[model samples]
Target: MPDAPLTQVLAPDVSPRPSACPGLWRIVTARDGGICRIKLPGGVLLADQADAVADAAERFAGGVIEATNRGNLQVRGIGADHHGLLDALLAAGLGPREAAGDDVRNLMLSPLAGLDPLMLLDVRPLAAQLLRMLETTPRLHELSAKFAVQLDGGEGLAMLEHPHDLWLSAVRLEQRTWLAFGLAGCPAQQRALGAVPVEQGLALVRAVLERFLDLARPEQSRMRHLLDTCPADAFVAGLGLAIRRDAAVLAWRRPASRAKWLGVLPQRQGLALGVAPPLGRLTPAMLRGAARLAREAGDGSLRLSPWQSLLLPGFDSARAHEGLAELAALGLLCSAGQPLARLVACTGSRGCAKAQADTKADAVVLAGLLHQGGPGSVHLSGCPRSCAVAHVAPATLLARAPGRYDLYLRDARLPGFGVLRATDLTPEEAGALLDLPTEHLDD
Candidate 1:
């Protein structure tokens, strides 16, 4: 249950322009038909909204709704009725306040942002503010749909490896709370370029975005792309703002978050439940059931995690097991150590033309062959686009052809799915090698 009904909300009279990315209004044409990506706020979607999405998918487009790796929803196989589909979603209060603001709303927070017991800060307020800035500011519309930001509240359940164009983390120096800001990399790996007082968050974001737009060419879509040409230090030095780089702020680093994503997560006040649809594909029933559970047992809202799961926060911890039981009934993977939890697969030949193998169908066979969870996470991509995951997974099984793959292990010395461990292995061979429970693959 969100604070208010996102009811028939039309983001004032604005028409979104055409782009490669999909939006409520600008449905991008795909091999299937059209694609519409619904960006959930903090990845929170209400039960009513879920129902609305389901209805829209069934009536106005093809019934194939996809749960994106970034925790948003995308509907594929759209027919000629794209406008009708957009209207249905907008009527459900799923569209942005400004049509231009749709793609710019890429901000990721931990699913348990406000509720996580081990969090240093509750990021709800700042997240809301930053979202507003990106939405209402007309200049930000010039940014690419792929230009994204991350806000780490220091929650134990945070996703830290995903690279962001602009990142901010909660940090304490001396006796005061400040936000450490960086550009072109994730908060976990890159050192903070500067810090700003918590109160200046809006101004800080404005400055960084303005600087990015000011310097970047249209061809450079992402911050990292621009940074490739312009040195990070030169880019930072050009920002005409007072940035604090003292030992107190610069000496800090974003600490590691607990990797447990699916299960009952403890909250400061009560409890929150995290669950994922297997391989992130949800039947309409599964979506509706989770939404109903969120409304009845927890807060009236559901937060979607970057791990391709959904969370219901503010539930009574005493009733957690009861809620967990209900979630399990919805065909969601709740337990962390489950074999399917560690395996990720893209929409292979079943959905995309470039795919040689049906990765989703093959993932099922591979999961059964593996028989158990291992020390690392594995991504099975049809091609190398790696749509199911944004960050480099601990292990990658890149499909070469039908039932054949190239296995890559997580190696610090390499990039893009890490070191190539083996090639041209059958699914059984991959399972034999990946089933080993050795040292932790990633910290």
Candidate 2:
């Protein structure tokens, strides 16, 4: 339970600006019902907090919990009992320090932040400081809800492709660690704008945010939007921080992470079991069972990953197989090779009015078809919004109607779901096309 009282914690000058995105206080209405997003600090949720979410969903919502791409969780189909749901989560220490801080708490960190064996530094302390600053600062709350930051400790299991408004990656310089940063992009594909000493990470973040707020207009809500008018170099120059932008910083690229998000993950001291709720939707039983496993077999906490999965960290190596079995029995995809594990879909016509087809149902059917062919990562979008994934997928099926879709294969040179290969095809047709070898598709 949280130390803060409900009355004091629940009401904190919450005047969030208008946005389509969901936040704890801002329950955006959806086709199904109201949606309340819970932003986890560093994506860490305690066993008891997970229980509170499960209970709240079962009581106040339709029992559908979604793992967001940003390593956060959102309860969809919430009923009139939004206040009741919020209170339950607040009691579980899930809410931000203040209501105003809820929307600005959009920070991404690796699920294996402190435990990854290959990490250059443990960034938990610095991440915590940044989170606190976001929460406590009144001026920062004026920033848009979509504004986000990423802190990478060089974890081998980190999500490298997700673009953030501001991203800081750990790099070594002269045998000392520094933070390589970029604007409006990710570490995997984008070059770092500059770098700062490890100790100045927090200062650098503050300066950057202040500079953005100082320069951006009301219409310019995101870093990318502002960058459309202001050059990247000019934006960095205004940050007022001593940033290293030499050849070494500009040339450094984040190593491609081939690590899988499922199965038993290697840790510094112990093993962590990675599991995902099928299609990124969790039932109450699944959430409770995972929380119980975290308490019984691993650390008493669950870390949400950007892969739309969960990691039960600090578990004994001997019980890895046992834990994997438990998660599998809970209907989670424990292996990356599972056809369903590689498929991502957003809420289609069932939840969003903009969706032309039921993307979730189609993804399930497509998964079965691709099982034998071993398809790569595929994304099914209800519309052009592409809400389910932040990065470009190997394959994309954009819905045109109830069962028809436009198939696209990712092309670096082409924008907007890459190059469209076929239009107005059924899921079965798309499945057959996707099963073809890469050489055949490229032709």
Candidate 3:
């Protein structure tokens, strides 16, 4: 367990390497207020815990809660009562097992880890072990707060674009399950660096982390940084594990999941309902209502998604539609076809000093304009930080001023929000151009 109250251990001056990111212990100040991030295990939140979070947001903060793109929840606009908020959340069992563990517990699993109808292996058990090691091992706690690991079960509803420090994808070789892994990238963008037998996955992870800590300099906080200097082959050679770098594993690619995150989601045994609070911000009332609905109509748990949405798993298939209506009434986007469902926006000038424009408000306007054209995913960023979406969006509206934006279309050959299509256009103008066929954009 953590040695002392997180409030004491986490004073800004105490950390050997202080992080700007918000955690349970470190409530970073922002333009709006202090932000306290609460990480969820495999993105699961119990119904009771949901209500507690809602209460804490209303009682101790400004009642604004955000579902992060990484499948976590953060309380925004926190006031002086940081202790009161932490106490409430800890009481609800939201804090990591050890207070020092809070920042290191960044293991991402598919939102439908065990429940997905199309999964190669159930990764929940392995994820549990990995999370425990990350928390209980004091040596591993030295890792950066942003260092993350992803364990993919080959679920059809998985988020494949978000890069991680270390990622493992399930694969079958001669009818035997194996884990193909890559460093510093997502499965979709990069080929597997190597493969290990399923049972050897844990040992491989431990060795890789230890190796990284040994070789990485202070400036090389992420895997990509280290890889820039040290060859990946040399790093793998020292692992001392029998890795399969054979053609079969090297040529393997993860199939793209075109599955919609919102609406009635098919499950292995039952059904799940996916929902998103508007612009990734949840009101206290909306949260409490979702909790009440979870308790009454579905399983007593909710799962957060990388899409900045929530999922109510284990719901009765017959009653899933009813739950969808209830969720919609609570102001959640409950369908794939909803215009707002395809838009992601960061907290702009309203809450972030770095922002030049109100991205959230702009996103709302863009959504209305895109309503007639059908659903197309877009990201609105107030700055280059791009806090809202980890993966690149199909189209990006980079804000230059209060209402002007530079639009970029996703292109494989181009980097950083893709190729720039237009410079300094209003949302309405961008909408008109985006409405045209893809071939017309280049002209």
Candidate 4:
């Protein structure tokens, strides 16, 4: 438990390390108003907590809630009454156990961490221990708010592209489950540095964190930054843990997942229904409706996914389809075939001072244009920051002006949004080009 009471810790005057990112207590001002981000443990939100968030957004803010790419939720368009909002959320058990822990509670687990039929191991227990250690350890509060770790259970529905400062992935070797880990990258792309027994997972995590704090300079806040100076091999060698660097462990790669985030999804025992808010923005009614359905049809809980979506797990196989229909009726995107589901956009000029165009509005127009062609997923960014997505999309439309963009295609051979294909084109023009077949667009 934290040394201070919840009320005392959430006091406005309790200053934490200054950062631009918003936390439960730290409301960062934006063009839309102050934004308050509420981090969820393993992205799980109980039905009651969901109701509390919806109530807070409607009562204190503009009722504009956003599902972040990191499987967390943020209330946007906030007005004054930050205290009132914080109080409501804290009372609902949305805030961290320790106020200082708010910034450091950045462990990401698969939406189906324990429910996936193809998972190598159920990572929920180890994930809980890691989260608790991160929250209670005052020394670890020094970690940057943006610093994050990922625990992969080898679930078929995991998000494997988002890079983390430290990533631990489940791998089987010699008929035993061991955790293969990498630094500053995701399991889908990076090779493992070594492996440790499943029972020693907690010890491995603690040693790695302590070693990082010992070696990292103030400027080197992220693992990638530190690794630029200290080699990854050197960093691993100093962890002082019994690690297996055998060929089998080093050569193991995470299996490719064909799991989809929208519509009905298969679980180990039952079915889970997935839905998304168009453009990742959820209205108060939308959230309240989902919460109500969660209570009636599901397990009274919802799991936010890395794809900026929601999953209602533990549903009876018969009721799952009906639940999906109810969610879709609430204006949620329940199928990938929905044009808006295939498009992602950041808060554009309307809500962000740095934006040059209105991306959310433009995405609607672009979605209409691509409806028939069904070109793969496309990301529309108001600027170069690309705040809406952690990984590159198959195609990108970088906003240049109010109604124009620069288009790029993902290419493994190139970096930073891949190859620039066209510039200063309207959404209509970009859609026309994107509607072509893959080979034609590449040419």
Candidate 5:
């Protein structure tokens, strides 16, 4: 367990390393009000817990709850009752295992980590162990909240592009599961930097994080930033652990996940239904309805996705389609062909002070225009911080001023939102351009 509350341990004057990113304690003020983020373990939320969150948002906030990109939830427009809201959430078992563990609880796993039929291994056990180590290690608390780790268990349905500070993907060699790891990159785009047998996976993660904290400057909060100065080979050598860096292991590339976040998905055994709250904001009613469905038709749990969505797992395949219809009827996007499902927007001027345009409102407009264009992912940023997306989307519309934006397409050769393809385009113009073939824009 961690020491005292992490918020108290830091010098209050330091103000969370000068970042506006929201954590459980550091509720960053926005145009709407104070935003309190609650990090859910393994993206699993029990039925009662979901109802509790909805109640907190309605009672202590402006009744606006957002499912975060990192598979968490945030209560927006929070009033003066921070403690009240915190108490309500804790009463629902949403707080960190220990107070000091809150800020560093950034770990990514597939929504179906344990239940996926097509996965090579069940990641829940290792995930629990790794999370415990991250919380117990006091030194790791110094790392930025943005610093994250990903544990991929070869699940057929997983988000593979979101780069993590340290990423480990499960691979089988000689009929035994081994964890292939890389630094400052994603399993889908980068080759494995090294591999460790499954038993050594937890230790490898610990070593890598500890070593990173030992050498990185305070400015280098991300692994990519640290790698710019530190040599990767030297960093690996210093781990002092037996790592298999053979040609075969180093050359391994993770296959892209063909799984879709919305619609019906076949598990190795049963069926699972995926859903997205429109624009990542969940109405209290929508949440309550989903929670009811989870408790009745499916497992007693809900899985939040990296796509800023949620899923009802362990569902009866015969009733899965019916459940999807129910969720869609509640204004949630449940089909891949839904236009809003392809659009992500940050809290803009309506809710965030840094925003120039109401990205959420504009996203709706863009979605209407792209209604018949099939599913195409687009991100609308209130400002350059890009709070709504953890990974690069196919297209990004950076807000320039009210009702206007400059569009960028994701290009491997370009950094930051990718290549700037159009400037000073409104949502209407961007929508028109996006309606063209997917090849027209870089992804």
Candidate 6:
């Protein structure tokens, strides 16, 4: 389907329930300025599109582009010229197929969907069908902007931790491929409610969504909310389609993926270079430089990962190092060993009113003090919201006041940022504590 023009899609007033989240049409106001989220299809951004986003950010917004956790890009600190920013994006074919479809296009796929050497299936084709179904179907538009679905191809570098309203993973059964699905959870921690033949994947998705719409009240915006009252078994039974619930399907669990997203990554055909913008914030120059490298040395496209990074696929194995060098020179984090690369921080007091501290700056300071042998990942959140990360990190620094935070270590036995270990500690104190051996921190 062709994308709707900016003029045709600007009427957010017509919607029954307006979204607070930033969309192509709905520019949400914030402490800095305005925010415009460009929902990319499967996180695939072409070189030209990347250039357009850079130009748009530089022209009409604070030149800050963010790689969102949902595998999308958002322009932050936008100025008064919302229409001008929307126009430049739309002209680059960034808008949805229909005016009402903008907020409903929330499907996620692996960054290496088609090229992963270990993938059991290529999920791109089915992902395209599912996205079109979500966008073109007006009934689905009534869904919340936060409603999301994940389609996993069993890639080695996949993000299986982020929870989704609905998730499907490719599985091999009886010499045939099937999609094992669950509701209101992630594949890494949730059991599959049922399985459907690969051919019926689309039909299964449509059935689940339509059933949700039929059963949900206006207040129950997310699938988890509805499941709190309705049983998962009852919901699956009502899908009105043949589903496999046998032991083989029910006991299937997605294997934990240990593949790293930074530096050179593996692809079936060629090497891929993965780089991240420090603290998930990308400047116009960083974006433009990555796009230029993609056009020159890669497949002319960049795939954003759920880890708040970008991957340039299809680079020759020999040129991967050189390509990584170019990206590193442009202020992109090309190696995971970089201290800043291991740290994740939200927009602190500078951009969010709720933030108690400047988490971004604090992260930089904390990164330098970090030792090489502590927790692999640490998340610095301005407040309890922890909006920067969908999944809890190995260690968390929750802000209590300016430059002071409470430390939490991720423990599955506890909930909400895991077990709180210390409180009212400055970054220096926190760094000293974090540098302790793993056994000591665990104790």
Identify the runs in model 6 with alpha carbons over 4 angstroms from their true place.
1-5, 12-16, 439-443
Each prediction's whole-model lDDT (CA)? 0.81, 0.89, 0.87, 0.89, 0.85, 0.90
The C-alpha RMSD of each candidate to the native structure, in angstroms, is: 3.7, 2.4, 2.6, 2.5, 3.2, 2.4
- Which residue pairs overlap in candidate 2's backbone? none
TM-score of 4: 0.96
| Cα lDDT of model 3 by residue, 1-443, tens digit | 76665554444223334899898877888999989899999999999999999999999899999999989999999999877788788879997635677888898889999999999999998888898889888888889999999999999999989999999999998999999999999998999999998899899999999999999999998999999998888999888889999999999999987777889999998899999998999998888888888888778999999999999988878788788888899899997677788788999999999988998888888887765436367889999989998888888889999989999888878878888889999988977776665652321
Ranking by lDDT: 6, 2, 4, 3, 5, 1
User: Model 2, 1-443: lDDT tens per residue?
Assistant: 74655544454224467778888887888999988899999999999999999999999999999999999999999998666777788878897646788889999999999989989999999999999999998999999998999999999999988889999999998899999999999998899999999999999999999999999999999999999999999999988888899999999998878777899889999889999988899998999999999999888999999989999999878889988998899899998888888889999999999999999999999988886437578899999999999988888899989999998888879877788899999989988888776752321
TM-score of 2: 0.96
> What TM-score goes with each of the models?
0.93, 0.96, 0.95, 0.96, 0.94, 0.96
Once fitted onto the true fold, the runs of candidate 3 whose alpha carbons sit more than 4 angstroms away are: 1-16, 372-375, 437-443
User: Which run of 10 residues does model 4 get worst, by summed lDDT?
Assistant: 6-15
lDDT by residue (226-245, candidate 1, tens digit) is 88998887887777777888
Query: Model 5 over residues 1-443: C-alpha lDDT tens digits?
Result: 75553334442213334566776666777778888888887898999999999999999899999988878888899988676777677768886635566788888999989878779989999999988887788877788888899999999889899889999999988798999999998888999878999999989998999899998997788899889999888899999899999988987888889887788877777888999999999999999999999999898889998888999998988888789889988999887677888888999999877898999999999998985546468899989988888778888999999999999888878879999989999899988988887773433
1-443 in candidate 6: lDDT tens per residue?
98774465555323335887888878887799888889999999999999999999999999999999989999999998776888788889987735588898899999999999999999999999998898889899889999999999999989998999999999999999999999999999999999999999999999999999999999999999999989999999999999999999999999988888989998999889999999999999999999998988899999999999999999867788888888999999987777788889998999889999999999988988976535577899999888899888888999999999999998888889888899999999988888776852431
Residues 157-272, model 4: lDDT tens digits: 99999889999999988899999999999998899999999999999988888888999999999999999999999999999988999899998998977798888998998888
Q: Model 6 TM-score?
A: 0.96
Task: Give the Å shift of residue 118 in candidate 6.
Answer: 0.7
Candidate 1 has which clashing residue pairs, if any? Answer: 1-300, 1-301, 11-97
Q: In model 5, which range of ten residues has the least summed lDDT?
A: 7-16
Backbone steric clashes in candidate 1, count:
3
